[model samples]
Target: MRHRFGRRVCITVISVGALLSSPAVPAVAEGAVPASAANGSGPGYSDDATLRGKIISRLQHMTVQEKVGQLFVVEVYGQDASTVSPTMAARNRALYGVDTPAQVIDKYKPGGVIYFDSRRGPDNVQDPRQIATLSNGLQTAALSQRQPIPLLISTDQEGGAVVFRLVAPATAMPGNMALGAGRSVTDAHRSAEVIGTELAAVGINQNYAPVADVNVNPANPVIGVRSVGEDPELVSNMVAAQVNGYHDGGVATVAKHFPGHGDTATDSHFGLPEVTHTREQLEAIDLPPFRAAIAQGVDTIMTAHVVLRSVDPSGAPATMSQPILTGLLREEMGYDGLIVTDALDMQGATSTYPPNVAPVEAFKAGADQLVLAPQMDVAYTAVLDAVGSGEISMRRLDESVYRILRLKMTRGLFKDPFVNVELAAKVVGASDHLRDEQLITDHTTTLVKNDSDVLPLTRDPQRVLVTGWGVTTTTTLGNAIGRRGQTVTVLETGTTPSQTRINQVVADAAHSDLVVVSTMNAASVNPITGLPTASAAAQQALVKALLATGKPVVVSGMRNPYDISYFTEAPTYLATYGYTAASMESLTRVLFGEVNPVGKLPVTIPHANGSGALYPFGHGLRYDG
Candidate 1:
């Protein structure tokens, strides 16, 4: 109940006690919780006197402007500042409203800079070398300032579902849901460790990863495949494994979307998601995994933008709610780890307030760092003005900067913040990493539904018709599928296919001895659902068309596991979690009886025609070898 004084705090209290008799907590009902609920005695809360002394020492050398700068961690191109022309900087200023990544550091004096996939320098040049050089320059700029603090260059390197943003050049691992399906804590650790090496190799010290959200809602358009599974305990255990792996690989970890991003049907990226679950329900379900994450000693906790009505009756986003951030996470949960807000650029956090004031509000709400505020200049000005006018206390500002600097010190940034540009190029995307990535995909390639016992697919490669959406027609999986002296008519379906177009492909299925189709159907609400909805529909239509031909269709949901709900009549079905080349190779090996699939379904595969699951969470089939 510390920091619980405002009307906001009262509303949160109401939410916590709103339904005491509610069935939200069976464990609480069964007397599973400890007597102490709101005490700040947890492992993540740093009462380390020495660390506090170091933070105090660091604070003594900083000015008010410097202290304010330390509270912001905004976006930047992870490239050298020298390479950027003044004209390009102006263009970026005009386009993105920032002078330059380095200039922003010089002016705003931010604590960190998050990297993204953008054209570095004036030209559209992209490479790992640019990333390393840019990081070195950003750190150098930080150190050369009045207060020589190293910049914490961070990225969203959550290795799951897809090879996205910064980690594209590195080895592609099977994502979180796939890792859960494989059901190996060892694999989860190894996968994160491998990703960490790649991240560190490129000079990224902090990784916003190991999504702790349990995918309890399949219609949850954003967190669906990104989450490990729907089960809380299972997600908790996997989150711990990932934290260990990140540490093992020497990367600072941030276990994110705290409290939980699961169970919400809307995507926070597009707009605010209204979470109506009672506090009891959240404690029993969503809160446990985060509690587990804290026990694992996570470095940072990122807040979700979603509004939990139970926590705030006025429906404030968690990032801007003192009740959620300080009351729940900091006091009740006993987590003193750095509280970083999710990008203030998202609609979920911005819909209620003018986007420009996010930085000030986020800090007031208890967040240590303002992350990725798109309106950086306006937000930075807001913070400066607030601190100057006494709207925000100077002491409070120092506390956040202390945490930020302490994290930098913990990352060994003060001593050796720079990476060897050459070493970065050599170590990043290492050849050996591919072997590890392949192993992950091999284990994660789940055979979700094989009702016809047609897996360990017959090796007769005589004119096999291979059709898929999302993946290229001919890749490692396609090549391997036809390796047994057979020709494959690779038919690639467009993401937006006309029904007539799907009909044509179905008509062409007559010439082939066997038909195999792969569809990517995992759903996430990016503030709006129907991500590739048309493609899912087309794939379903293609399958139904093939079914009409009596061609004994073999189907694989290369991305989403829920695809089995759409193509229920398939004699054979598979869910590979990801559509990567590595996953495709694993599917090929499984098809030829070279590898036995031990993968389980991470989330429940809902029945296509209804609300129930065709195969529940943790369901997977085996071949009688």
Candidate 2:
């Protein structure tokens, strides 16, 4: 079961270069310290004067290499601390001159480590217990160094499309757009708190979450569903709520992609995205959520790789724009928190600069922590060289290192960096957490269209065909319907199903009494062209083929709700916003009248003809309404 706040606070007392076996101190909390903690005064973690004094003393003794290492938070290719697949071992050896995560920490001594689990490639997480074990091992290695400092362990557990690293066995949320649809700050906080509690129990201390971007562009590929909604006010409210939730859940919060990544059509992963909003428009729309985040005292703010033409005019992404990061955020907004770069390895930030130069440039641009440098060893050395040549002043470098160490101390990492590995298995994916997640999911299953009152499955169609994009998710939904006493036939139409497969599904649907078709961003916009992909075309074709069969068709949108604008003729439509099992189950309940659909549209669904909104924001249909 999920423990209540202040119920499981276990503090570990730590001093530099030594593990004191003294009794535990009553730390502030698992994931956070007070806002004053940043200035060297917070209870539980450390006494204020002592905290600052100790960090200074430690800094005095550290070598230049060690100080430079503190600026980076790199990714290692390994599942376990000491063991890795042969291919992964080779990659690790090539990158860090080591074959395991623990060894990498010992050799290069990065201030932090970020976890990835097949979302981008390579798996550092397997299950809750394994993750806790790995975190403990990494901490042990970091502490074993000459100048011991506990590593900041972080992952992108944003709870929807971005939760791939820690999805299963960790409560899966319906994501930010879903929360926006619900429009309930209480639900948003509860959801993030549950996610945060589960992560902290498993030894993950930092979360890159509560995406503060107010997604204004419908064609935005990266931040579409991940964004809370297009409305800046609503997104701001949700962002603050989620920030508090994560902190209360025992993890530090990062409000991300500042000054904003919402108004672009480009995906920074593959190319540079430019946001051209004027400073006035930006303040009105894109910047409010981040402002709210700062008001909520968010632990960190991440820089986007997108360029804001009005802000810098240097044609540089915000990751390397000192004007945006230091001037706008630090000086203008009065945000004194850590500023981290979006992964430097991404094409968006490093396309112009080589691997070695990007990290140094990001530091020069006022980022406190450089995340995911492509080549850690080379980047580390480059930063060291730049500092040696006074290219990056020692004062600037020390400012970042102090923030890094301060964050570690405030988050209770120095006090107790290890987690109870055995308890992690029990705490994560616990029934209580799942129940809270289900409650949030229940609020996010939006009924966008129910023409002719076709929903509630009141006719009790005995034969139902459940077919969609993901095989596992499709089968899961079919099983849910089957549990409701329907004879359901499950078919997996690939994301871009072949014509033969579409034909096969159409034939199968003809024999069924009701056809439920789920689309996974069927009309997904291409990042570069701002047009739907061929896969989207194929998925649309499959839906059209099914509709022609004359069965009672229920089109379910499992990812983006915008797909509904394309198939305007569908009699019934629902937007789950995700394909997580919890969402599918909630969707099944809404279909069979077990629950009522209360979610509104977070973003406007543009008409296929490009005239106007087919379904405006805040539009939803309840069975009774």
Give the alpha carbon lDDT tens digit for every residue of 1-625 in model 1: 1121122222222321121112221101112111121232346434344455565667765665577678888765424564566666776676355656676677667887877765333332146677778878888888877668888878877876453555546677778888888888999999899888777876788888878887777777778778888888888888899988987887888887976889887779887886777998898778877888789888789999988878877678889988999889988887767789998878987787775577788899889998877666567656766654556765577667766776777677888998888887777778888888888778887776666676676666577878767556335566778776678777777665577778777877888877888776622222344343655666667778888898767788776577767657777888787777787888888877787888988787665444687788778777763
Instruction: Give the per-residue Cα lDDT of candidate 1 at 305.
Output: 91
C-alpha RMSD values across all candidates: 9.4, 8.5
- Give the local distance difference test score of model 1: 0.73
Q: Model 2, residue 523: displacement in angstroms?
A: 2.1
Clashing pairs in 2: 12-415, 31-250, 31-251
| Model 2 Cα lDDT, one tens digit per residue, 280-355 | 9999999999999988878899999998989899988899999999889888887767889999988998787798
> What lDDT score goes with residue 410 in model 2?
75
Q: Name model 2 segments beyond 4 Å from true.
A: 1-50, 459-461, 526-531
Worst 10 residues of 1 by lDDT: 25-34
Top-lDDT structure, candidate number? 2
TM-score of each: 0.88, 0.91
